[model samples]
Target: MSEPAEDPQELAALRNEIDEVEREVVRTVDLGPRAVVIAAAVFVLIVGLVLPWMGGANGLEVLLGQHEAVGKASWVPRLFATTSIGFGVLGSALAIITRRWALTWVCALGGWFASVDGVLAIWSRQSSAGPGASAPGIGLIIAEIATVVIASLWFRTAWSRS
Candidate 1:
């Protein structure tokens, strides 16, 4: 069978796309073995941000739209349900790549606090009255789990090094 002739313009575009993907992956590989796990955790956390945190809408929906942004207590879940991803990604990436002790503790402590917030977030959304509550969604749960793992990992790494 004769192969169809490839268009030069299309070929060039595809090549560029491939190169861009390669560069992105390379950036994620800076921490060696730790990089893989950290990247997965970060990916999970980010994805969770877009998923249903509770209520009828997903996290982005709540954050972007009519957020219940009142009361000091409201900030508990809201902060963890969002900033955990930011800290997880930024803290883990920097701590791992830089191998600095200060950053390690910062990530470990921050992650631990965030993990607790995640758990409480789930608790706050639960229905004591049964069947009536919206119940926690996968996104908040996944983010919570990832943050726990990230905290544990950073803590373990810090312990071993010390």
Candidate 2:
């Protein structure tokens, strides 16, 4: 077969087209990781907020009682519930905006702390326990521990992704 003559203009136009295609591919590739990270972060944040509102209040107080005295009478329960809901909402907001590993670390530590406290609460709720023990028994304790662990693990994994 005889070879056709190549035009300089044609060669330059083809090069430009290839360069644009390469640029688009590179841009898309770069966004892939970022998109994954953002989605994971959003998911973690949503769970963090939702967990407390949906039967998480009791578990949260159980967790808190381990570290400090919870009166569990009247306003005391309400106070702790509100606090948990507030923090959960705030933490979700933080996770959405920040990419730093430190924030993720904070979330992990907080989860662990809540879980440990929850165990202590179960201990306090025994039949022989004092009146101050308020509500929640061994069953709630087990649930809270599981929830905290799961949340912590999820946050940790999300943090590590980036």
Candidate 3:
């Protein structure tokens, strides 16, 4: 015997519901100029990673604790590196890719927190400067600036969204 056919009306309703969800998802993403600016700042933060941060070591080396400066480096600078990578790089990337408003808020808050970490990192480096200790390098400064920019842009974007 042949199986009964599915209800066409029910199938059409399900398809319509799926389409509405897809549209809603697309609508929640922020693909405007602010997002582009935030992405650019994140790029700068990434570039800062490869530049000199502590002593002669790059940001990555300092983060990995593989440099000579690592022995004398304070916890603040290390924490700054970790947050920069976590929120500045990874969180921003996820927010941009997902285009979700909630993610944007999360990234914005994380960026602000990272910016604080950056300031503390710089202060730690300056205060600890001695014969063996190194001052904050150009890369660290750049990363701090980038983090601030990202945080500001994300804040503006989140605020403007309805």
Candidate 4:
């Protein structure tokens, strides 16, 4: 004769148990030393936000469209600011804290995207400069460099797993 069907409650319990085990496995995975470097770079990026970016306006001012140059600047700088804060600082922090492989991949990809945005933002600032126009601020440059470093480190960490 054929075997009786399994109990529904038992099957649900088994599924929950399996999920817990999977989560434990993911939690135990190490991201190696690069995670520390990523954290430091994120910190640098945060510092960059408070420094002057355009027309003596800080990164936060630029992002918020409160800077005088914001009216003249293209969308590149604004976009860079969003991604840098969103992916570089927040996303990276979450991934580092959780140490989840999927989150790492997400941060890695987002970091690369933000890095490209950083380059374009710098280029836009330079290209748009005119007589008596203020040059790109030190903070912007520092933030861009930090973004690149963070992206590269995240890529290395994510790729190392595979």
Candidate 5:
């Protein structure tokens, strides 16, 4: 004859344990990307403001190219870049201050925008057969990607313990 089945309480306890484990796994898998994206967004914000005003070898100028001819950079492009930078800085600050995930998401979106900007800059160089043809600023793209991956993994691992 077969042995008696596990008690209902024991079975339920085992199920709960399994559920807990699954939750931890899910949390671990998600944290790294979130953190990376947020950090990247903050970086973008800083570049956005300081680059336009200061105009130097910083990430902004490097990524978007200098506007040696202010006339060459029209109002629309300038407006957009300025807006993005301001938003990035504000959103990131809010997130950091409040420790709110929603704010973090805003920061991530800005990061996404920054990443896109980087990609577009690279593309423009390729199309124009400009200096970007040599794959300049490629390092920034790699760094951003690396940031995303590392942050995601770190977030996942840290949250898993909770």
Candidate 6:
């Protein structure tokens, strides 16, 4: 007589699927130019945080403490800082790593919107400021540029995937 079956067809299929998933986890694929651009975007966004975003207060200072906001610092800088890093950079990176197509698009769009907001916010702040107020600092400018690049890269990578 044949030996008893250890598992039913359904169970065997499930086991096979689990093994396949394990293998996929172990295997690596080339992320290539897309990854490089993504990394640079993230790096640029991060670096912008440390640089001055306004007359004296930097992105980091605006986010961490309100002490630097002694003058008429608007909330635009803080809002942009959080969204740019939290959603634009981090969300896109995570979606790329997991290879989630839908998520990639979401991140790309969100990042783009956030980047636009950052740019507009800076302009709004500058326009609203009293005469002689300093212009938007270097950090805001760099972060905005990086966020735009990040959005573009994400879309490019997603579309390029076959």
After superposition, the stretches of candidate 2 with alpha carbons farther than 4 Å from their true spots are 1-89, 127-147, 158-162
**Residue ranges of candidate 6 with Cα displaced over 4 Å:** 1-30, 70-73
List model 4 lDDT by residue over 58-115, tens digit each: 8898889886667755478889999999889999989988888777778879988998
Tens digit per residue, CA lDDT, model 2, 43-90:
443443334321234335433543243444323233323333333334
Better of 1 and 5 by lDDT: 1
Local distance difference test, each candidate: 0.72, 0.45, 0.86, 0.84, 0.46, 0.75
lDDT ranking, high to low: 3, 4, 6, 1, 5, 2
Ranking by TM-score: 3, 4, 6, 1, 2, 5
Q: State the lDDT at 118 in candidate 3.
A: 95
What C-alpha lDDT, on a 0 to 100 scale, does residue 7 get in candidate 2? 98
Question: Which candidate number would show the highest lDDT if scored against the true structure?
Answer: 3
Residue 17, model 5, lDDT: 100
Q: What TM-score do all the candidates reach, one by one?
A: 0.67, 0.40, 0.83, 0.81, 0.39, 0.73
Candidate 1 differs from the real structure by a C-alpha RMSD in angstroms, to one decimal, of 13.4
Looking at model 6, the pairs that clash are: none
lDDT of 1: 0.72
lDDT of 1 by residue, 44-139 (tens): 877887877766556665445444432233455677755685568788878777666667778889999898888887887773334434677898
- lDDT of residue 159 for candidate 2: 53
Better of 1 and 4 by lDDT: 4
Best candidate (score: TM-score) = 3
TM-score of 3: 0.83
Model 4 misplaced regions, further than 4 Å: 1-23, 26-28, 130-132
Output the TM-score of candidate 1. 0.67
Compared with the true structure, the alpha-carbon lDDT of candidate 2 equals: 0.45
